[model samples]
Target: MTEIRHYKIGEDRFKISEDEVARRELKVTKVADDVIQIQEEIHGIIALVGATSTVNIKKDELKELIKIVREEFGWTDIC
Candidate 1:
């Protein structure tokens, strides 16, 4: 198994490196009326295909998601 290391960059962001020069961007799209798909791409190359979930994101679930983003980005609250 490969051991992944985490580095804390300046204030609110970090970089994940794998000894490769790649600029990855996450793409989230509504593949179907109710199905959502996510993917990771680097220079137009699809690196990973993310999970597909229902578009019906509940209130509680959304709150938890918001909390996760806020904590990770060092955002205590949104203005």
Candidate 2:
């Protein structure tokens, strides 16, 4: 069995798991355009097409994003 830990970056941008990092399954980085890129890897080596969105989100936008991610990905309750 593999032990997994969690890592968080930025103030409110990400919540990553140790398994994800060790396997390179996820990546989130802030680009110079004030946007964040969210990536996921599949099948051990295949890289899925990722999404990039503005990171300069206000309170309302943050709430919306949290809601969407929660509904789609089952993220932890942020509200």
Point to the candidate with the largest lDDT.
2
Tens digits of per-residue lDDT for model 1 on 27-71?
344344344343443443335457963333445545644554455
Model 2, residue 72: distance off in Å is 0.9
| lDDT to native, each model | 0.41, 0.41
Per-model TM-score versus the true fold: 0.30, 0.29
lDDT of 2 by residue, 1-79 (tens): 4333222222332324554422323334333233445444333333445586333434654565555455544555556
TM-score of 1: 0.30
For residue 55, model 2's alpha carbon misses the true position, in angstroms, by 2.6
